[model samples]
Target: MPFYSSDSDDHRTPPVKMFGRQRPLHAVFGGGRVADVLLWRNKNLSAAILIGAALIWFLFEVVEYTFLTLLCHISITTMLVVFIWSNGAELFNWSHPKIPEIILSQSAFQEVATTFHVKLNQFLLILYDIACGKDLTLFLLAIASLWILSVIGTYFSSLNLLYFGFVGIAILPVLYERYENHVDYLASKGNRDMKKLYKKFDSKVLNKIPRGPVKEKKFK
Candidate 1:
């Protein structure tokens, strides 16, 4: 009788799988929108590639100019100093540098350094994106017009126009590619996290909600 009762209970109702096709809440809020924007912004591969190429060429051209060259050096130094100071202060008790060092060793410092590296790489990616295509073209045209006028200036007379142009032609593409790759990596990681979060919530709360066939929207 017990075995028969157990059999009847088993046939009473099949267990419902608590995983549904509910959209991720975060995805609905802004994750998908942000992803769309990121993709849209990066869609014109040709334009981005060309801009990167041009900037590289221009950078090479300007590398030899004493003022521009000095500016690059100064900019790099300033960025490094800012990164170290900001991150170091946050990571360690920079108010007492020696005390923090004694307590945490250089390992804490190294962690801060790593954070700076990540941030700097991200900044470079942004800069590379901005420096190309519309931005680079306008900038170059303006600089060229100025350089033509400056040709008569004795101090600016030593500029190597041909060499600078050649360098820009050579370098920008490679730098742009690096930035593109980094951006892609970041995007993928973000998407993956969003998917994971969506799945977690969907399996729990969302499954309990009645679901219907999802209608797709077509947007031009």
Candidate 2:
């Protein structure tokens, strides 16, 4: 008798992995059309999106095209094509071109706005805490993060960073999902090593540092 049955009715819960990501990749990405595109489950759609993004980025960064110019060109081209097609259809007694209706959902916009509002407030609160010197760890971490970003900004233009970010977002998730086990293993090992190093440094250096008596702030 096996400890665990491999029958259709097993219903055994899976062991949780790193970062508490127990759900399938699709579920983790919301299990929707967008998730499908992002995870490359719909390879054609994903490739088209990536290629289109690359083309736009190239035009903006490499060709030095401004947003206003691009918008104007696109609008002019679309108007010319529609006008000619509508007039030609009337003259030729052909069926009218059926333009697809683009409907923007209010709920989707509200959801996005709400999420942004919450995240922005949270970020502001964190910044306030850091500025007030509430936590030394968080303050140092924030400084380090900003300093790193500043260094990166010096080397890369804003457009270059955006393009790189888009490319990474499109590619990295699928790659991670494909080699999730290997990635998790490496990440776990790296995390343990980092913890050990931090502990060693804290004991040897941070623990030896002399501290001055702190003066408590008086509330009015």
Candidate 3:
């Protein structure tokens, strides 16, 4: 007799296209790619919002202050705001992009988290050092300068000068903090081993690349 009679039947069917005519709404909102929108949405929105805010603030300052003071306030606030907004936007962006799901593999995610933690720790350490260092003195100096300027403005009844002076004074510490943070980050990342590796890699690739179109020597 045969080993078995043909009594069994396969019931599985190939997967059918469930929604041939329908499309996901999220695709439309995300411009057809969820990751694309997620990665860049915060940055784009933040830039537009911040730029608009800065322009409005500048106009206000111009109307309420002398041209010189208005210019000073604009210059200082622009730098300070951009530095802060960029970092804040980055952190917000990271958090908003479904961070856990974005890094599906545990090992890969762990590595990224570790790297970020290290950088963050370094940044905080630098900030702590600055706080313990000259931050207090700087704060006092800033307050004194602002108060003096305000008093002068008041004596002259110059609202413009007073307003712009106060704004500029408020921004000084923020600017200093951003600058210090940047310097600290650069210092932390500028490790000897990394520098050597980068240099070696650059030499290997760049030094071997041929220079474009050398001009022939023209003798007079």
Candidate 4:
């Protein structure tokens, strides 16, 4: 009988993650501090973010406040407080409130801009592919997704959707991380079922459909 060393097991590579993810969840979410915040490792920061989002949602949805009105009100209140403080400090010979200077780095701005540019290009490519009718399944999926979104848009205002998205971001990631094994198992099973159904549909219905020679346009 061969004896395996205990240290050898520890040295083995980690098993592949769910949803065909090559990296761990932390790395997939860009790793480091961002992942920590998302996973609620920084509890204080995460709670603060949720509280802020809740306040915004309450202001817009419950209070029926317009964004412009809220902005102006906040600006006026801030200015009034600062104005009073600045003058009162002069009269009492008290120290003025220290306002920290904010500076935006050029490199940070460029990085953000580049990321958006890349994402925008990727979105445009997806739309182009869907429009080109190359993949029937992809085109149908896109159409169905857009139609569902359109229906959802009719029921909820943009602000409501934004708030809901924020709430989902705050909740879903943490829950998923905690129950990742069960979630991944269900997701994989569902995906396999979907593929089987798609294969059947393709063979039964799609194969019978007549097609014309598709003209592929070269993109410059």
Candidate 5:
């Protein structure tokens, strides 16, 4: 009979995490202090906290009423507006007022126009390149995703997007860890299918297309 000792294999610690990457809830959204208790000890509690916080944030974003916003601290601008309105706008009105003409000057409009034109041209050029690129499949996929998001926009508040994304991140890691083998098997199957489809298309459809002439390199 052979006996194995505890000292046979030395224990190794987890990799060093930066910006509190070791933290539970903070690490999900951003890096912060390591919440050892919540992270390693009680992950379920951490998940609950994350879910509850996301829900609270969503409610805060959707309910932006003036007085209600103050207690929630939804938006400082909203609170200020409410304060001004409640105090009466006439309080700031002076007998002599000298509003600057340059505030609405055509020069400002010209600057804005120039900026818009430059940015619009850049956007168009990028779009054109994407359309002409080999990554057209991904470009079309992105467009489809945008269309789906537009449809989703009609039914849900934008805040729900952030809320759901945060919750998903918090819950997904644990789920993936528990079902890694299953995920890997499914992923491998999908990869094999895609490769086969690509090969078929290359052989049957792509082979029928005429090839473009290769350009000769110009010597400097």
Candidate 6:
């Protein structure tokens, strides 16, 4: 009478959680091998990549051709788009929209300008809110990230760096989801170690310091 299967086959234990989520397809990574080490999350991988990128930026004289090379790539992309549009127009018997006309259209320009203006205003408001201490740590970190990016941007093309960042953003969360348990274990271990270090420092260093003059029972 039960709707569900009563056989032992239907009640087998589920696969282990990867990262922090239930097993995703990629989590079937042939356990306990080099593939696990290479594909799964590793803390040192980040540091290694950053050092490598910096070395390549300098060794290849990336600064000299960064913008020039970017322009060449953009030129090629523009040609490909134009080619596709021209062919599509002929095949579909559609009128070719003149680029100059589109650029000069008052309504089109106004709509584009309005959208940009609204977005810029919203961004500025969020920045002002952060400056007012909505989240000082987040604001400071964002500024630091921008400063580092500007320095790196001088030596590397912006598009390549931007694309890398976008790819990391899109991919890292899926990876973490797929290996959730492993990631959480590493994080908890790090937290415990840091807490022990801080406690040791507090006891051995902070406790040795005499109370400063400001704390010496401030006489009225």
Which candidate number maximizes TM-score? 2
Reference-based lDDT, residue 101, model 2: 93
Where is the poorest 10-residue window by lDDT in model 1? 13-22
Model 1 score (lDDT): 0.50
Per-residue C-alpha lDDT of model 2 across residues 12-95, encoded as one tens digit per residue: 422235555678887765566667877999999999999999999988998999999999999999999888989899799978
Return the TM-score for each candidate structure. 0.18, 0.70, 0.18, 0.69, 0.44, 0.35
Write candidate 5's Cα lDDT for 139-179 as tens digits.
Answer: 66558888998998888876777677767756665564455
Tens digit of per-residue lDDT, candidate 1, span 1-220: 0111233433453322112114432232234322232233344653465465565545655454455776788799977876787778867867522323346557656655665576588668755665565554334545677687676454433334544454454444334334644544444444445556667877897788988989999999
The C-alpha stretches of model 6 lying farther than 4 A from their native spots are 1-158, 213-220
Task: Flag clash pairs in model 2.
Answer: none
Query: Local error of candidate 2 at 7, Å?
Result: 36
In model 1, how large is the Cα lDDT of residue 214?
97
Q: Pairs clashing in candidate 6?
A: 18-178, 18-179, 18-180, 19-179, 19-180, 19-181, 20-179, 20-180, 20-181
- Candidate 4 stretches with Cα past 4 Å from truth are 1-19, 89-94, 105-139, 208-220
Clashes of each: 7, 0, 2, 0, 0, 9
Every candidate's lDDT: 0.50, 0.77, 0.49, 0.76, 0.56, 0.57
**Shift in Å, residue 73, candidate 4:** 1.4
- The per-residue C-alpha lDDT of model 4 at residue 131 equals 89
How well is each residue in 92-202 modelled by candidate 3, as lDDT tens digits?
Answer: 773322223354777656655765576588668756655565554434445677689778766654445644555553444334334544533333333323445657866
Instruction: Give the Cα RMSD of candidate 3.
Output: 28.2
lDDT of 4 at 127: 93
Worst 10-residue lDDT window, candidate 6: 1-10
The per-residue C-alpha lDDT of model 5 at residue 133 equals 65
Error of 3 at 130 (Å): 2.3
Error at 189, model 1, angstroms: 0.7
Between candidates 2 and 5, the one scoring higher on TM-score is: 2
Candidate 2 residue spans exceeding 4 A from truth: 1-18, 90-94, 106-145, 211-220
